[model samples]
Target: MAFFRPGVSREAEVRHHADQEVGKSFGELLEKARGAEHELRRTQASRAGAAELRAAGLAFDRALTDALRAAEAAQRAAFGVKAYDDRIRRRKGVATPEGARWTAEVNKLRTLREENRLTGIARVPRPFAPAR
Candidate 1:
């Protein structure tokens, strides 16, 4: 026989909703991170400011910590640790480590493109000239 609590407290119910909201917020942050990554990839590192990249990196780190905290809180409310661990382990989605990896990917592309420009291996043949 399984022993069960008679009443599910309002606190538990509220926590469940909070967990869902937190997940959504985290997802939105991930989307922002992706956008930042796209912009960085498109921009040449020589032209991009280090300060902007640093801010983006910090935002991603903060979002990741927030997501982890929210997951832990949800597990607490659910009263199970194995299930939470299993879910995280099995998770396969856009919300993966792509957040951190994006920075490196963008930087790699920037480095390659910068090297090409320095070596005169650009796609364009010549600069356009204006009529006198």
Candidate 2:
């Protein structure tokens, strides 16, 4: 601390006041930097969460498409038609149509959600053997 000397001019007091103001400004800057750091962390976390959701959406979409394809194949095998014809439905009991059964199938490789909704073949699920 600079003691006030009898000879010290008024300029010393002015210098001391200026220094105090500058110190206060530095404290405010420190607070602002801390706030900015906190906000950056929060933004990063939100971005990571969004990325995971996008990945899940992609996974769900792929599973649904695969399921639809499998269900179509099962329907073809069950009803002997690539497309469901009403004539067949009228002749065969409603029980035979592929639409009446399996809503979802979960396997290790892929989740067969749509295939499960497609038809009866899922009910009698045969091990998926690659086409001979």
Candidate 3:
């Protein structure tokens, strides 16, 4: 009896592709966030000795706020969560090893995806089952 399942491998391939796409998107978001942070820092440093201290201070504040907002937005997109007007209002922050709180949510999503894939495979009838 042939043990190889035709569609099972294809389904796995599709899942892998989806995982890659999600990973790529997450990487892009992180990169963008980092870039924004770098730009904000550069702008702040350039205004360190300027005569217009008040204007520079205001600009620095705005840039810092924007950078933080971008970071939070990127994090939300990576985790597939709804964007909120207030960043701190979304989730009650939890403590975790290595400061990795909110990872449980990510694990939950991955588990759901794996379960879906397994369910799809299970729905495929056996190819060479003995007579009932």
Highest-scoring model, lDDT: 1
Q: What is the C-alpha RMSD of each candidate to the true structure, in Å?
A: 13.9, 35.4, 25.1
TM-scores across all candidates?
A: 0.37, 0.31, 0.28
- Encode model 3's per-residue lDDT on 1-132: one tens digit a residue: 879632424544454445445444544444554454455446456654333443433444444344444433333433332212223423422232311333543454345335433431222234796788
**Deviating ranges (above 4 Å) for candidate 1:** 1-4, 25-27, 42-44, 47-49, 62-132
Per-residue C-alpha lDDT of model 2 across residues 39-124, encoded as one tens digit per residue: 43454556545444444444444444544445433333343231233455433532553434322221311333433234201123
* TM-score of candidate 2 on Cα atoms, chains taken together: 0.31
lDDT of predicted model 2: 0.39
Runs in model 2 deviating more than 4 A are: 1-48, 81-86, 89-93, 97-99, 102-132
* lDDT, residue 65, candidate 2: 50
Q: What is the lDDT of residue 14 in candidate 2?
A: 53
Clashes of each: 0, 6, 0
* Candidate 3 lDDT score at position 57: 39
After the best TM-score superposition of candidate 2, give how far the Cα of residue 40 lies from its true spot, in angstroms: 26
What is the alpha-carbon lDDT for the whole of candidate 1? 0.45
